[model samples]
Target: MSLIAWAIGLALLLIFIFALLSPFEALGWWAGWGKRGLEPSPPSDEEMAEAQETVAPYYIVYLTAIGGVSAEDISKRERVFLARLKEALPDAMIVTDVFPFSVTNNPLNGERLLGWLWRRIHQSRMKRSLKGTLFGSLIFLRNLLQVAVSADPRYGPINNVGVANEIAKSLVRHGYPLGSGAPIVVMGWSGGGQIAVGVARYLNQGLNAPVYVVSIGGVLTDDPAVAYVRRLLHIQGSKDKFPSIGDILYPGRWRIVPHSAWNRALAAGKIITVDPGPMIHTGRGDYFDYRATLANGQTHVERIVELIADFIRPIQDVAQPA
Candidate 1:
């Protein structure tokens, strides 16, 4: 075989192996792997502004997109978008340090053995190389598997609760008073959506708080946790077909499945679907792209922040979890 063919075959083999092992970290974490350092490292000075706790009407714990290297190493567009979100909702406390991709909250880009590989591929992606786009997809694929695990009936309970506890700890670190029953809104971007829904019940149970979810271009599973969610706001762009895949592949998301968590939420009016209009899942024209301007002169991020900020502001509910 030619060198190109050998390379292609090797890549295919690696991907197969990667997929097989994708669930290892989550499963291991639940099985007590890496239990010692579950708490995330202390934030740097740059992150302290959003890391500290404060008395606010709402506590927003953000889950970065699957492409994240770490909670702190999100995309420039995401960084700008999040900063803009904090500015838009000064009354809300935003905790951006929770890395939901790992049940133990360990970043893929941190001190792990594969951290260097992730960094190299991530940098290639930053340079917009074809090689980067191809290899960087491994990050997306791995995180997507974690989302599936969170939706899987067999593992969802154990893993989601573990992740929820990790998130609760992060919230406490950020100054959240556990058992305060302060409303907790999880803002999930991209693959973060299913994760947000997957962990809602546990977050509510752990913190005794009213748990809400706000998903932007998130591919959500019809996880049973949706049944316990206080409310959900799914923000999808009109042109983004990525989210539709969740419905296409997950039978629970189908209409005929009347008792599915998704349908139940809809029947009970607990889910709100909003079309931000003319947005893609990611990249140049996606929701967080500050360069994409509408005829009204607002960037796509600005427009989305305006919509989400409005819904979040008047939420002063003090309901505790059952």
Candidate 2:
């Protein structure tokens, strides 16, 4: 090969290697990506019959957190409010124990030199100093080279929207196939909020039924996807950090307040905002306390449950002649 051709080939090879080593491919999974393996078996036949008969016109969806916490971790704290919800709406079909989606982990292949070169080209940027710049760049390049040899195909592109659609379809197939006639309320915390927003947006196109979505400490953003959930009731607490208001990339690097700004926008709307009191701030852990009511005359947890009920309440109430 000509010297020029060799250099061009080498540069391309390096870019490809870097792409392979880039940990950004792991973006799809995030913290809560593969938390749940698969959908649990549906309630028994008798339970289904009972659910159909007793469950109200509303569907209750509980979205799990993506911080690697188990569903049990969620239920332990939120059970008080969930139990109250169950009691208030006896026939309501409540579905918890479902995860966001399955993430196929695709590690880089480390067999070929060209592959290694490809991986090095795709890594994060670095500085200009000997230690801070060159050293870091070389380390990143080396890591990319290692990963390029054995790349996994599964991590190519994640269909988060598709996962949300599947969850919606499951709700229809198992519970109310006819949605407009019934109401559906979805509540998710953290990353679960992202998936819940996707499900409601996709389903809302077909079924105009009142779809109420309440996200606690959810990672809400101003992206096109989140715009659909704008009409859905969204609640954000004041203190919880982590996934606070939009993409929080590089902690302490440059704080971008997308989620916080979104909350500000909602505050100007007709949606009811509930403060979950000061317990541990973020909606993570067992902070779903129903008793902590803010001065706004509403308890964060209880108000959430009540919102679900009120949202599903028939539209003919006030219209009825007194």
Best-performing candidate as measured by lDDT: 1
| Residue 179, candidate 1: C-alpha displacement in angstroms | 1.8
Best by TM-score: 1
Instruction: Give the clashing pairs for model 1.
Output: 53-174
- Please, what are the lDDT tens digits per residue for candidate 1 over residues 1-322? 8999998898889878877887777677656575444333333344445545455666888998888878988888998988999998776778888898887777887777688988888888888888889888888877877887777888888778767877877776676655578898998998898889988998887667889999999898878899878889999999899999899989999999999989989999999999887999988999998999887888999988988887787674443221
How many clashing residue pairs are found in candidate 2? 33
Q: For each candidate, give its TM-score against the true structure.
A: 0.89, 0.52
Encode model 2's per-residue lDDT on 56-130: one tens digit a residue: 355667766543222443444567778877876676677764544322212122233343532343232223345
lDDT of each: 0.82, 0.48
**For candidate 1, which ten residues in a row score worst on lDDT?**
36-45
